[model samples]
Target: MTIATRRAQARALFDAGVAAADPVAATTRALVQSPVPATLIIAVGKAARGMAQAAMAACPNVPCLIVTNDENAAPLAGAQVMAAGHPVPDERGARAADMVIAALEGVGAGDHVLVLVSGGGSALLPAPVQGVSLADKAAMNNLLLASGADIMQMNLVRQQLSRLKGGGLLRIAAPASVTALILSDVMGDDLRAVASGPTAAPLGTKAQACNILQSFDIWEKCPRSVRDHLSGVDTATDIPRADNHLIGANPISLRAMAALVPDAHVIADPIEGDVAAAARVICDAAAPGITLWGGETTVHLRGTGRGGRNQELALRIALEARARGWTAGWVCLQGGTDGRDGPTDAAGGLVDSGTLGRIDNVAALLANNDSYAALEQAGDLLITGATGTNVADLGVLIRP
Candidate 1:
């Protein structure tokens, strides 16, 4: 196939992966099969709006509260939609958490709470514990994001600092039966890590949270209040367990992408850890047909350059492909299924063999951690605005 054809096909595959994880469809299906007679619906995450809509359709007249990032927040009838910061905690998220907590007030044994959970919920709903302030939580989040910590590790610490995470929501809604329909953005679909497991079990003890921060070498950099809280915390009581369902996730989307090309190689292992290392692994797996991967990757921010993991991964893959002398004809499209990559407007990048030739001093740019600028110059940045649903990320590479 021509390079252009390959790029197009790769885009198609990625789109298919995203489509497969459609929140409305997934939520609708789950609700139809076993609809929850909810007295209140709380949808939180990137897919909150879509999931809330479906739940409301299934259980009409139900009081609903939707908390999501600005990208996915929208007005819906019979529901209060609140937008908050993502990838970092903010005052707005803190207020939203208060609203969420208040909404759960007086939830009794006869009442049922339907919680729609998805990616970005951790940051979108910031209910910092008493000792920790919102600013402290935000500082810790910034540190964790730049520390190259994986979702699980980041969330393990976040759970300790928040009153709405790590089954804290379930705790607040005690005596009320809670049901959670989760959209898995974490690689392994560990529901507990998704949205910091607001309706699930706590990851570990506060000591474990401290260990994660120390392991990442960001323990000392953490705000003093955060340190004090985690160090002193053992006062949390047992949390109630909710009936959780896996409504959507990354693996399901990855398989959908691979199915588009029957002979395509579907890497069962998710793309994770350091971006450079992940790039090399992907390059090594490249064959003479479409190859697919799913899952989020981490980037240890070295410079002030703007770009998300997907953008950086695409550029790194291009560099790796060239270094391996396998860039004769290849196209790789990597993007977040949610269509918002990091703090940039681009979802990710669709890079081809010629992508390197279009950039100036690719090494310097990569070293500066400026994948967004590099990809933009190459006309490769994949910009798909707020997909309304997130199943982590999807990647497709077509080589001939």
Candidate 2:
């Protein structure tokens, strides 16, 4: 078999995984027979549009608001749609969050607030707590990203700074019956971390947020307002009581993919490690079957690499396969569920042993943080534009 053949098989398995964890279909089915009449639905994140479409199909005529990345605007035709920046807060995201807060204000005691929550919501709906500017939040976020902090730690810092996160949105929808349908991107499906748990119960302490920043050596770079907010001098609002449900996650998606591909092996539902090291493990272990792993990874960003975690993982894995004298008939893929990796337009990369064999300066590319360029030259960058969904990172290794 050729590298192309292996990649094709891996792609099929990945698509199967996504189909199995369809947030829209799953959420719609869950809410179809509920006796409570949903008065308003706010769907926020990469999966917002799909989840909103499903919600509308299940319960027609309900007022709906969909917030997603700017690139996915066309799918949300009938709803009040707000396209915003992601992975970092921008003015547009803050504005959308204000709209969501206003929408919550209209909910009556018995009215239903159906929230479609997923990854990227934290950045998409950036309603900062009083006294924090969008620029301030953006700087903090960038600092965290470059510092190699994990999602859990990053979200803890974000929850403290945002009025819509850390269950603050639940407080805004207080007295109303809130039902949150979540498409989890975080490991363990920690509801409070997914989209910063806008509609879930608050889970972290102020000290925890401060510690995360301190550990990353970013406490000084954080905004003054953010620092004051987490210092406990002023009391922050708490997450309100709401019924939250996790509709989809990496485990579910990886399991679905495993079922589609015979002799499949799941490396780990929550794979974690140094990006390059993890790549070496995958390349060494992949056999004559499909291997799946799902979870977020951290990048230290020492090099000026124009690559995300998934892209870097692919490049590293390809290099490892070459080092082991492995050629053709093996494919490795790493991609983010949100269809964006790092600050690039790529979802991730799909490469083979042949790719490494062709590249002469692989080390230079990796050292320069130019995995995107290297993968592109090797014809291995995976480009799915935007999938309109985010559950985390998905990696597939196939050997034939």
Candidate 3:
């Protein structure tokens, strides 16, 4: 198959994976037989539009409010849609936050709130903590993004800094029955951290959030207001678990991908550890069939390269695949489900036995943290723009 065709097929497989882990669909189906009327639906994340559409299918005529990234706007027709930013908050995100708070305010005791929350909701719904300016939050977010901190740590800080995150939304909508349909993007599926757990119960103590910031050596860098908020915080509230369900996650998505490639060997769901180290493992264990894995990985960011963890993984995998000298058919790929890796437009990169033959100075690329540039030079970067889905990462090794 042509390179384009191969990528198209790979993406189709990825989409099937995403569909398999759609919490909104699962939650809606579960609620279908229940007598409680879902009067208001609040969907938030990159997948918010798709989730809203699915929820609408299950509960026809329910009023819906969708808060998603700017790229996902068109998919949420017929609903009150608000397009916001991702990875970083903007004025639009603040507006969406206001709207969500207002929507919750209107929910009565008899109303049921169906909350569709997934990854990226933290950025799309930015209700800054009192006294903390939006600019301060944005600056802190930038630091966290560049610091190579893991999602959990980053979100811990986020939950502490925002009004809508860490079960705050659930509290606001309390007395009203809430059924959170979570499409988990975090490893281990910590409900309190997924999309900052807008509908789930809170998990950490304020001291825990303070500790995480200190562990990362970022406490001093945080805004004074943020520090004061964390210092004076009384107690971590419990996420309202009276009614909640995590219907989607990396494991479910990875399993679906594995089923599509029936010949493939399925590995662990959230493949953790260092990126380069993980790549070596995949190369060393290559067999005759496909091997699949999923989950987020950290980059550590020692180099000045312009690539995400997925790109870095592919680059390292290419080096190993080349060293094996088993030319031609073996293929290894890694990508984020949201179709954006790090700050680049490319979803990730792919490598094959022939990858080394087309590239020069791979070591320099690795050293400079310039895997994206190197992959582009080698004609290997995978681009899908924004797929409007976020379950985490998908790694595939196909040897035939």
Per-residue lDDT for 256-333 in model 3, tens only? 887887777777546766787787777766676667888788777667779888998988887777677654676777
How do the candidates rank by TM-score, highest first?
1, 2, 3
Total backbone clashes of model 2?
3
lDDT of 1 at 74: 76
What residue runs in model 3 are displaced by over 4 Å at the alpha carbon? 1-12, 22-28, 31-36, 239-242, 302-305, 323-328
**C-alpha local distance difference test of each model:** 0.90, 0.82, 0.79
Residue-level lDDT for 184 in candidate 2: 92
lDDT (tens digit, per residue) of candidate 2 on 217-314: 88888878888888975355554688887788889888888777657878863777679777767766677677788878888877776989999988
**Which prediction has the highest lDDT against the true structure?**
1
Clashes of each: 0, 3, 5
Provide TM-scores for the models: 0.98, 0.94, 0.90
User: By summed lDDT, which 10 consecutive residues of candidate 1 come out lowest?
Assistant: 232-241
